[model samples]
Target chain A: MSHADPVLEIRNVAKQYGQITALTGVNIQMFAGEIVALLGDNGAGKSTLMNIMCGALPPSSGEVLVRGEPITSLHHAQEMGIGMVYQDLALAHHLTVAENMFLGRELRSSGLAGTLGWLDSARMDRKATEEIAHLGISTLRDVRMPVRLLSGGQRQVAAIARALMWSKAALLLDEPTAALGPKQVALVLETIKTIAAKGMAVCLIAHDIPSVLAIADRLIILRRGRIVRTLPAAGQTVTSVVSMMVGENDDAAAA
Target chain B: MDRFRHPLLGGNTLWVLGLDVLLVIIFQLASANGAFLNPINVQAILTTYSQVMMLVIAQTMLLGAAQIDLSQGATAVLASVVAGTVLVSMSAGGDPGPHITLPVLFLVTIVVGLLAGVINGVLVGWLRINSLVATLGTLGIYLGTAQVITNGENLYGVPLSIQSAFGSVYLWRVPLSTLLAAVVVAVVWIQFRRGSFGTHTIAIGSSEKAAIRNGIDTRWHMVKLYSVAGALCGIAGAFDLARFTTTDIGGHGNDALAAISGAVIGGTSLFGGKVYFFGALLGALLALILQSGLVILRFPPFYQVIAIGFILILAVAIDSFRNRNEMR
Candidate 1:
């Protein structure tokens, strides 16, 4: 409702896996510089939606529009600048933070008629270090240390960092705080806030009601492969959101 | 030593070192003579190891990236024949062709080897064929092609000048070919240790699904990796043919198996992820030493095969345990 011009618009999207319907007539709009959390139970179409948006899966019907244009090709996905970070973090455990940050988008120096390509490690390291500092992740001190040496929280942060470094448009994070301890969850929430402040749109999927309340600017609840409700953060409580998420009547009226 | 705890050089490095120590001890025990430790014999061992070591080095790079090129040995054999036949035919038919020039011949042979590798890459990387099956198929294709070229005829009296430069020449008692092997090992080690290639390679092998989700261009990376392996085999083939002074038909039947065994013994894991180039170097050396020890022990050539099999199995077992530990 607060959107001026929606950054992403999913118009009547539907997806099916064999005989099972994963998502049905799901419609949502995401705006820039906002943290929108999708709340759902297990297999409630939360992952299906993110997968469709991230180019991991194709919708059976309808369209996904970025800046009012539908995505139809791989180049469209890359050009739209949407990035995804899965629950596994996808941070190469063998690679250093700098290497992971610039994994795909490596900058190489021009050699002999522009034929010899060499990676510019110095520049990549400097940029990765700056990004790490900006995230307020002090535990990740050595940019050269492999992600295997990193804690769960640091690995999550690094995955996000890779996304931010590669693409500037939108980030779709799936279960970003799942399996994290309380302290790590709080740190991730802070990182989410910082990401939004940088004018980047974030779509976070979570099952935890308290976590959504902590970081989300708005919440979209999906039940049985359909959008049930969209609520703003102002004047919202966990009780109301939980009832809405589970398809139960809100207690606000009786209270 | 705990001084280094890299994914590549962890407990696996210790395993490689232990194997080396064991091989040396076995060599000493089997020989029971001063000849085994003689510098001349050592140099001879180095010379012999240098040839297979080239193939092992290439195998290590591919294996590092969670790939294996079964056709590398066959490709080397084919290159040797191609270089020898083309040069001999050109010289005999007169024109002292550019193809016979050392640099040009070397480049052409490598290019031929690269073409063979590219075939495997296209099948495995582009067509998304299973690497083992794809390379296995090409292994037969390349070996068959080599046999056809030679037609069971050995090419002798190869350019003596070429032989002297690459084969007979030595710098302060060290063969130039051995120096070349040293350079290859050093370069690969730096790439794996100081560069970012190993990281990406290991990640690909560790879990292809994970690598794809992380935004890696897995297919393209694999193609490039296979090409590198091919180029190295091409070079090795050219060198082996030039040095051996004759192009023997079906000379590389055991090259692939030997290189793979050497890599495993050097602590490279077949399940992918993790590469130890120097360990591969040590592994190749151990294999060579064992062969020499067998000769000194007056064992048959068939026994050497059994020894290699045992070492390969033992090394793979140790590597698997190390892999499980690291995963935890």
Candidate 2:
């Protein structure tokens, strides 16, 4: 494995909600062209950490550095080429796929027509089609279909596509396959591979150990708001990872 | 398939249009000597409700954004009162009343109207007050201020030349005020249908949390939307002054209800995110036609109020049913 500079780094981030500590002194780094799976059991502060990294929630202490420069606010993160896809997939159901893809950043006509606020919908639709094709998303047959009509997996694909459209440095996906069926999960896994192959940093949060081992380069397991173990995925089995996650050697106990 | 879902035929605009045609047929069939279909009567009907149509357009924007403004009529009346007070003061030195130009009065009225709108916007958008309660409070404040200014009496003595210019000017047989309202509606329609502002408004109304995550400034956009509604009401106030040649506080009692009902009947939902401008216009015309038809049929004026109330209830019930299906 080549040792390269990290694209994103979270330094000693901590979060407190009144009397409870959701996360404390959490540190992580993401290098380009690799997928790092964030694994933890329930209430391990995985979501709180993700939210702080995505700029959705402010860390009570510590800072996030993108390409070695500190950033603040979700808008600032986006400007530095960091995109996040939430678990809910924030897609407007009434809008079409192309419209959702270009939401908040629509193209307008040139010169006087543009000045009059005439949307260049033809150009947007064409670009959306090209991008979806390039991304190898085949489930979305018609870009003009309202997002509400799309299957859950297709919606997930579209959300990822939208994030990738703006994110150049890092993509943070929160449980991208949590709600998908077996086939859809396989499809999303392939897309994640394609994303890493494109030289973008990918941070995936998932609970499925076999899928994570099959795809991730490194797995960092969290237990009660701290990174308990960082293991290379090349030779790790599900049994060994589960033992580490639960903080006990079940095989040793069985022997 | 897209054509089948075209907003014109398949959406709420269709019901408003159907109601409009039905009202016209009913009126024409009941009128002696086809009086309701007479061009003169049609012109009168069109002219009388032109100002209310403008207010309906304003209400549509608010409702589409999932906000409501009950203070629009009162805001317009306050704007007119401001203009009328100015003109009346200027005319006190002479027998023919004020010679203040229409442009100047319009400018003053629009400023006052916009100020009122901004205040409401600030309360509801910035302070995060519920829009219904915010506008309701402002409605009382604006109306009370107007009553204080006029001392609960009508303000008259507006220059006749100003009235003729705005109220009587016609192009190709249509009143200039109606034409002006049509232009406003057309511009608003384009903004709502094709502009970024409209897109953001719909997104905010659909799911404000989603819109916020996408980095849309929902609160600032709400302020702008309410301000625009206020500005439209100001323009309507200017037209109302021209049409009546007086600021009659009592005369505006039914305007808020009419505008809201018109917007609802035209298919603008009480729940935000969908707006049909043409539907609203047709809805306003439908109400006006029903009132006029009842008068011609020799029914007491009180029956007109009952008819309008019935229409409002029916339209809202149907809209909620349709929305439920769409959600499913």
By DockQ, the best candidate is: 2
Which pairs clash in the backbone of model 2? none
Least well predicted 10-residue stretch by lDDT in candidate 2 chain B: B1-10
- List native contact recovery per candidate, as a fraction of 1: 0.26, 0.31
- Cα miss at A195, model 1 (Å)? 2.6
**TM-score to native of every candidate shown:** 0.85, 0.91
**Per-candidate chain B TM:** 0.89, 0.93
Which segments of candidate 2 are over 4 A away from where they belong? A1-3, A178-187, A207-215, A233-255, B1-10, B93-100
Expressed as tens digits, the lDDT of each residue in B1-328 for candidate 1 is 0123353465356667777788778777668575577777777887777777778877877786678888988888888788887777656645353344577558867888888887888898789989889999999998888878778677775666567666766788887778887887667666555444555677787667777766677887777777777877887777777677677566677788788888888777776765777677777777777788787777886787787788788888877776577556
TM-score (second chain) of model 2: 0.93
- lDDT minimum window of 10 residues, candidate 1 chain A: A109-118
